[model samples]
Target: MIQPFIRVDGPAAALPEENVDTDIIYPARFLLITARLGLGPYAFHDRRFRADGTEVAEFVLNRPEWREAPILVAGANFGSGSSREQAVWALLGRGIRCVIAPSFGEIFQANCYRNGVLPITLPPAQVAALSAAAAAAHPFAVDLEAGTVTVAGRPPIPFSVDLERRLALLNGWDETATLLNAYGADIGTFEERHRRHQPWLFEGENDA
Candidate 1:
């Protein structure tokens, strides 16, 4: 099971560029990497590295302090263009558990939640404030229960998540887990009803 996301206590970073696509997040060439682990080095490969494979020090993530930041405050449409789950994996590889942005690609946002990442959609102004805070390398605390993000020396910023997704994150439940938890007994009852109506379907089983 994925770790429950009650809270995240760690440093944060900012990437203020708009419309960063999934391929940019995890370059298409590296898609051969089916494994979700060890994708940190490839996250924003072209943006963070040169043709010869040296680090691009100018990139915020390549900087020493922001390298391990677990929270990212990004610009509008942070993850757009494709339905690549690997993009979220790459972010996870960088220890990023939460991403704050004004908006995101629908598929990428859903992928984040399913993969144990929190994609917080805040107002543009709020996102900018968080970005500023991240630029200062302030540690952040995201309390899922409280629905707020707290940065050092600042008042808690409120955000909203879908109740279902929120519950899944808090309980560490994926889609299947959530469904089974919510309807396992109902499903059992329905199966019994179906078996009674069609005994032949359960001929080998103890339908009696």
Candidate 2:
């Protein structure tokens, strides 16, 4: 996942109320071990598409206007359910940059960060206003640096993110990235010392 703090380049729209889970975002059948190819099409499997395998035209994502949505303005406790990183991957693959809601599931929120998606939380009024703007417009932009979400004529609405996650997303970092940076030199030194102390660990120069 690439961690670049970008201006969210489209309108933000709140999802329908409540309990939007991982399975809704990405179904279990698609969770096979295959690499992430083609997951974007199945992004919101059962919601955007019907049980008969047809498009649900009335769904927010099914609407042509929302095809390029970059920020999701969702209700409280969004992304709740089984811990599946694939849900976050699907959202990212489909070009969603950030999600705004009153709250998010802890696991889902962590997955979002790991996958390089920014999750923003705002009050209920702000969420409603943003969703309304998205319904009325095409592309709204959220400037991460400025901490503002701007639509055509509305006041630039402010938003907030957790400090640690914000820094990680802005820098395109996950736990591994943080660890590597923090301990790279020390780890390298330790490896060298270990090799010297335990000669039997290496059988020959070929092993080195």
Question: CA lDDT, every prediction?
Answer: 0.90, 0.79
Model 1 lDDT per residue over 62-166, tens place: 999988888988989989988989999899888899999999998999999998899999999989988998898888999999999999888999999999999
Best by TM-score: 1
Q: Which ten-residue region of model 2 has the weakest summed lDDT?
A: 5-14
For model 1, state the Cα shift of residue 154 in Å. Answer: 1.3
Cα RMSD (Å) per model?
4.6, 5.1
Error of 2 at 196 (Å): 25
Candidate 2 clashing pairs, residues 3+ apart or interchain: 3-172, 10-140, 11-140, 14-73
lDDT by residue for model 2 (1-208), tens = 5758757686555584777888888899989847764568878888888789989888887777787777888888888988988888889888887888878988999888877788887888877877777777646778878888787776887887777777777787767878898999999889889989997876566843
